[model samples]
Target: MRIAELGRRTGVPVPTIKYYLREGLLPPGERTSPNQARYGEEHVRRLRLVRAMVDVGGLSIAAVGEVFAALADQDQEERGLVRALSTVEVAVTPVPEHEDAEAAAQARAFLERQGWRSDEDEPALRALVGVLGTAREVGHDRFWELLDGYARLCGPLAEADLDYATDGPGGWLEREEALERVVVGTVLGDAALAAVRRLARKQAARRRFGNPRADCGTEGSAEGGSEGPAADGATAERP
Candidate 1:
């Protein structure tokens, strides 16, 4: 197939596809002529993977490049691939000035309690510290109380994720394919899980609060009702 056909099949525009090629995100196609190149199914697959990482996973070009480099490295061991995947899986935002030493200590302590081996310089650990610090700064210090419950939930999920990655089909997959699956799965699975969590939260809120109508009280009168003051300083009275 040609570049045009590859773009059409992948629903990606030609210029964007060309941009990916220029960025080294997509592999070069086979040269058919001086000005023509022929792409194959692999190109199609790669393009889709690139789109998922950039558009859905929200990875920057640099991050995507790093991920691809790791994926393409024939000498990378499984442990190296996991570390690479971890780096791309989380977004490392710039840390604000005036760090909260307490939150950082708390995060370290929590990690230690969990018996998880993490380095202080790891991006994920740094990100966690930043989050914890910000949570405290925003007066949500008690939010850390949920750590234990969240960790419990994460333990099983992480185990299941490893199980799927390692024990697929017969017993263990080819190293290259396994690495690719882990990268793609980690990227796409995060988005899928977030959406599911949001949906579940919506359902839980509806069940607990009985929807907007219940929260706003019966039709209009605020007398003896649970409806709070409206934003405009008006009482919600019964119709």
Candidate 2:
């Protein structure tokens, strides 16, 4: 296929496809002529993966490049996918700064209690320490009480995640395709998990607090759809 056909098939514009090739996100096609190149199914697949990472996964071009670089560094015979995934995680997560000794100790203790053998240089451990420090700063030290419960919840989630990444359709896939699956799953999975958590939280809140909106709707209907000052003020105060 030509570049135009590749772009048409992937629903990506030719210029954007050209940009990806220039950025090394997509491999160069075979040169059929001076100004024409022939692309194959591999190019189509790579373009789709690149689009998913950029559009849905919200990875910046540089971050995507770094992830690709990490995956490329893996040994062909013994692919270090975990290391590649770690690189992807690091790219998505912000680097921690301003170490808090007390919070770091707390994070370390929590990890020890959870039996998680995290390295000292791990981004997540550092992020946890930062979170603990911020929680204390905001007078929410009580949040520490939920750490164990959160860890327990995440254990099953991690298992499910690994199962999803490793178990492909028909139980077989090329290494590049497997890596693509992992990248798509990890990046988009975080977003999906967060959205589901928010939905769950909302449901829990409704059950616990008894749907304030239900009463508000009734009151508004009784008042001929004229929300009173208190309702107006509350609405204004939101967001």
- Clashing pairs for model 2 are none
The Cα error of candidate 1 at residue 43, in Å, is 0.6
Local distance difference test scores for all models: 0.75, 0.80
What's the lDDT for candidate 1? Answer: 0.75
Predicted structure 1, TM vs. truth: 0.81
lDDT (C-alpha) at residue 53 in model 2: 84
Q: How would you encode candidate 2's per-residue C-alpha lDDT over 68-97 as one tens digit per residue?
A: 888888765125667777888898776577
Clash totals, every prediction: 5, 0
Candidate with top lDDT is 2
32-98, model 1: which lDDT tens digit per residue?
9998999998898888988888889888888888888866764655675576567556442344455
The positional error of residue 172 in candidate 1, measured at the CA in angstroms, is 2.1
